[model samples]
Target: MTNTETQVPLARFGISAVEIARVVAVFYARVRSHEVLGPVFAAHVADWPEHEDKIARFWRNAILREKSYSGNPMREHVSRPDVKAEHFPLWLGLFHDVLRTELPERTALQWGALADRIGEGFRTGIVAMRQPKDQPPKLF
Candidate 1:
C-alpha cells in the first residue's frame, strides 16, 4: 500500500450523534447557569435552543463526519467582546465534567483531550485577537 492513511476522522472514537446531542445539551445548560459564563453567553444568544442545535451540528460534523456544520467558531468567539480568555477554562472544565458523566471512561478521556486542544486554540486565538499588532506578542 502507498503511504496514504485514514486516521483523521474522529468517528474512530466511536462517538454517536445521540451522545453528541446529549453532551452539547448538558454542557450548555451548565454554561447558561455558570456565574462567569452565563452572562457573557446571554448577552449574545437570544435563542438558546437554536444555539444549542447549531453547536450540536458542529460536534456532529467533528465527531460523526456529518459535515453539517458551516459556522466559523473562531470568528464567532473572537468577535464577541464579552468572551474573555478567562472563560475558556471554565467552559472546558464544565465540558469535561459532562463528558465524564455522559460517556464511557475511555471515550470521555479521548473527547476531553480533544476539547482541551480546542479550548487552547480558542484561548490563544482570542488573546492574539485582542493583542495589538504593533507590539510584540506576549510570550506567555
Candidate 2:
C-alpha cells in the first residue's frame, strides 16, 4: 500500500488526557530549544510551571473536547510587541510536529488543520486590534 493509503483514520483512535500531556511535553521540549522562537517564548512565559499546566489544559480541551479552555490566547500575546505575523507559521509548524510525534498520521493532520485555523483567526484578530479602526483587516 502507498504511504497515504496506509495512514490511520482520525476516528480509529480516541484522544485521551495522556495524549494531551504527551503532546504538551514534547511540544514544549522543542519550543525550549527552538532557535527562532525559544527566546520569544521564554521572555513571555516567565513561569514555566504554570504555563505548562495551562498549555496542557488547552490541548486537552482542544483534542478531547472536555472543559472549554476559554482563555484568550491573542490577548496573552498582544502585549508582546515582538510577536509578528511571521511567528504564526513557525508556531503552527512546531505544533504540527508535536501532533505528528504523539498521534497517528490522520489525527495529526486533523489537529494541524484545527491549529492552522485557530492560529490564523488569532493572528488576524491581533493584527486587527493593532490597526486603526479605519484600516481594513490585515490578511495573514
Candidate 3:
C-alpha cells in the first residue's frame, strides 16, 4: 500500500450514522455467508432483523459514542449455548477480514484492535461462564 493509504489521518472523519449503518449491514451480510460461522449465527439469531438492528446500534455506540445501544452483549451471548470459546477467534478473524476489505488501512487497523480486544473479552467471559461456580476464575 502507498504511504498515503497506510498513513491516513486518525480523525474520526465524523462517520455519519447512515454510513455506520451501512457498514454494519454489509458486515453482517458477509457474516451470514461465511461457511464456518453462518450456521452457528443463523441458529442462534432467530429474529435476525431485530438482531441486525441491535448490532448496528451497538457498533454505532462503540465507534461514534452515540449511546444508541443499551442491550447487554454479554447477556445476549451467554444466553446462547452455541457460542463457545473457539467461536470467538473465528468471529474476530472474520470481522478483521471484513474491516480490512471494506475500510482504509488506518481505519482497518483501528477497528482490528478493537475487534481483538472485544473478542478476547468475550472469550474470557464465556469461559468463565462455563466453569463451575466453586472454581476460581480462569484468566485469559
TM-score versus the correct structure, for each prediction: 0.89, 0.81, 0.81
Residues 34-131, candidate 1, lDDT per residue (tens digit)? 99999999999999999999999987887677789998999999999889898899999899999999999999998889889888999999999899
lDDT of each: 0.88, 0.79, 0.78
The reply for model 1, stretches above 4 Å from the true place, is: 1-10
Model 3, 50-131: lDDT tens digits are 8888887887778776677997888778878888888898888888877777788877788678778877988888899888
Mark the regions of model 3 whose C-alpha exceeds 4 Å error after superposition. 1-14
lDDT by residue (17-54, candidate 2, tens digit) is 77777788788889989998898898888887778889
lDDT of 3: 0.78
- Predicted structure 3, TM vs. truth: 0.81
Candidate 3 — which pairs collide?
Answer: none
Over the full model, what C-alpha lDDT does candidate 2 score relative to the true structure? 0.79
Clashing pairs in 2: none
RMSD of 3: 7.0
